[model samples]
Target chain A: MSTAVAHRPGLHSWLTLIRCEAKMVVRDTAGLVVPIGLPLLILVMNASAAGDEEITAGRTALDLYILPLVFTIVTATIGIINMPSFLAYYRRSGILRRLAVTPASPAMVLIAQVVVSLIQAILGIALAFAVAVLAFGAHLPVDLGPAVGIVALSIAAMYALGMVVAALAPTPNSAVAIGLVGFFGLGALGGLFGGRDSLPGPLATLGEWLPFGASVEALSNAWAGQPVEAVHLLSLAVSAVLGAGIAAMFFRWD
Target chain B: MSEPAILAEGLHKQYGDTVAVDDISLRVERGETLGILGMNGAGKTTTVELIAGLRAPDRGSVRVLGLDPRRDRGAVRQVLGVQLQHAYLHGALTVVELLELYRSFYPDPRSTEELLELVELTGQRKTRFEKLSGGQQQRLSIALALAGRPQAVILDELTTGLDPRARRRMWAAVESLREETVILVSHAMEEVERLCDRVALIDAGRILASGTPAELVAQSGAPNLDEAFVALTGKELEIEEESA
Candidate 1:
């Protein structure tokens, strides 16, 4: 009956939220398979398909294209699909309602979900990297630190975009369906699948500014140990902010 | 104690053209348990939702412990607990896991084990929310409501569809709690008669009578709460007329 000044033990509180979300994510294996297995399959195909014929950009290799698709896959999986589904699930289950009445901040809930999705993206990258190395003879990235940065940026943007999609969708299923379309559509447009050279100049230019494309460019630059362009970072930052804002406006707990 | 734990004035809610909760006002004081009796579509749920801050009333205001439920939701929420009928938790999560998770929300949550023991679900702590029987789920729900140790608890038709023994168990469980205030929305007049200190008999979204059990029975010249309710509302003879 009394509202005491609610306090938690610092990072442990945030970390506990993250850990709980991660446990739920891992326990729901059906959700995990989509993000992980698909990326591995694509990595193998690209490594096998690597050739002059597969190179659309004059100096680009097939695996280079896979970098952006990695993010596209991650974005679709977490940002678009998982965001709405989980939000709806929480709202319906009264988990959000209970949490709404609690001392825990909504920002923390946002962070926990993003962390869970980021962990999944990490697993995807690890899986792809393993496939590239063992199955397709991919030489690993020279720069570990930069690669890590790229992964982090790519995941952050994807997570944010996912939040936007989840907020906009009418229902959880609708969010997932629409999210997948945009998820894969942008990836394909960003020259993930192939045939970028045949596209109109305006369309190709527009594609470069799209979410995963910009992220892929930054990540690939990072993997090559080259300094990342500030534009890429800015684009990602914008997507994230916009996404978080949308989630704040529309995210319902009860 | 001068101010009631709950108070509402001119509460009106509309979903487009449908007036769900039509201009209702009621109040409950500290240590008072108010039972609301209404049939389906009588605006019971809407009224409860309005008071609970689950929905924003289109007109008028609601205050729980002197704080507006809508405007001061977080502050008021910390002070009030609600257990809605047929409300459920995550199916995959065990009762213990659920209790632990819910505990994280409250600044000073009750001991999970003690709550389970109090609800008589101590042995079923490992059971998932879906795994428990209907009665067990109801008990766990009461346990969850008690989690925050709130000043007021609102139970929306807590005993509907429950068997006799289960209903009795729930009543006993509720009685043992030393709640400052409890508002029960139920159709069962006997359930209200058994547990409530006071009740508001509502029909068509308006309070028909408000008093102690014996007072209502005596005022209506009825043998019991049911007959009293039927007499006060004047709906029983209408049913009889329809049946005839």
Candidate 2:
């Protein structure tokens, strides 16, 4: 009984929010591709071939890269698409104005949304990991603890980035445009499609500072059971703090 | 005689050089329906927005339910309900779903079935907001405002696009909320005269006159509220025409 009370508007509300977010993204066929189906397909394909192709001279394998990359993509997808969708629909429909008069604070709504994105990111990573292990000869990260930390920070950073996009785009089209550009541009450079080595010197160094880059570097390090370097830890911490601060300062529901 | 549910004292709102709500002061007592009548830029919506805590006043204070609307906004929100001047609903959800969504915000939300039935939308409960007629959508907007089972309801242009029959139905619904205070804003004098217990006519961001319909008619020596409105706002109307 005590446990249930501890969760007032707790697990149930969060679960309901997840279902709601899923329904909106799945409302159209095009929306479905971006969230679930596409990520899973990449996970399966990457994991099998990852073991064969030598990622580094040491044969680190592509399967190891898949988990962190999938995590970043899922976080971006949840924020990029859903954040703008939330604002656009509400602003257009005057739901924000209605909510402005309700006891439900806009901050609470945004927090719920961030929670939803985190849940989706975790689910997508789990699925990708499953496919990598089952389909390909992939091993679980040698240090699972730090990998989980990377996931948490990655969600925070991307959710903040998503808010920046949501705040700037007054229309849904603009939001989608901005989110897509940032997603692919940052995702690719941060090692989603390829490793950081392919980039030029300055760009590779710059990638290390990005939210996506921090997660990528941290996760890759953890899979090897190496301690997370100060640079990587600082990068992740900076991304988390800066992203959350800006999101809180700039977020607009209408 | 009782304390007003909504009160504004020397309220002012300005956007740089232009004044949106120009030192407006008004009050609506408990259970009294107040009509906010005005020309296009007369600041009716601004006043309502300030009173609803969507905007803060640059000068003076607004108290609703004995709490400052700006300082105690969340508490005010708990007790007050609002229907926007423009009816916009999230298109992704059905009527029933939208009601349920708002229902979650309150500790004691009204039943979804009861709210839909009140708006005569039970038949279309499964339909998305866009799928409904303009009048039906407006009705649903009003339904959402009442979801919290509030002490006060603000309906801005409640029946703007409604056909005569639908408008009549809306007025009936408004009139039926016996225990709730309502503030209705509209351009139609007939809506004011027919529905509101007391009316405040605004011209150029200020109230021209405020009194019960019978009292205003007796004061103006006009046969109906329409002639009285025309007489009170005739000068403001001329200014608008010349500017245009």
Best by TM-score: 2
User: What level of docking quality does candidate 2 show?
Assistant: acceptable
Candidate 2 per-residue C-alpha lDDT over B1-244 given as tens digits, one digit per residue, 9 for 90 to 100: 6677888899899988989888899898888899998777788888898888889889878888787767876667768899987757666668887887777766678999889889899899989887899889889988989998888999988887678899888988898899898999887777888898999888777888889988887777878777777766774332112111
State the lDDT of candidate 1 residue by residue for B47-151, as single tens digits.
988998878888888888887777776677677888876566656667887777666666777899889878888888888777889788888888878787778
lDDT against the true structure, per candidate, is: 0.72, 0.75
In order, what is each prediction's RMSD in angstroms?
Answer: 4.3, 4.8
The pairs that clash in candidate 1 are A79-A162, A80-A162
CAPRI verdict (incorrect, acceptable, medium, high) for model 1 = acceptable
Question: What is the Cα-based lDDT of residue B104 in candidate 1?
Answer: 60
lDDT of 2: 0.75
lDDT of 1 at B102: 62
TM-score of chain A of each: 0.81, 0.82
Model 2 per-residue lDDT tens digits across residues A9-77: 334445554565455545645654676666787676676656776554343565357766776677767
Regions more than 4 Å wrong, model 2: A1-22, A25-29, A44-48, A53-60, A168-173, B217-223, B235-244
TM-score of each: 0.86, 0.88
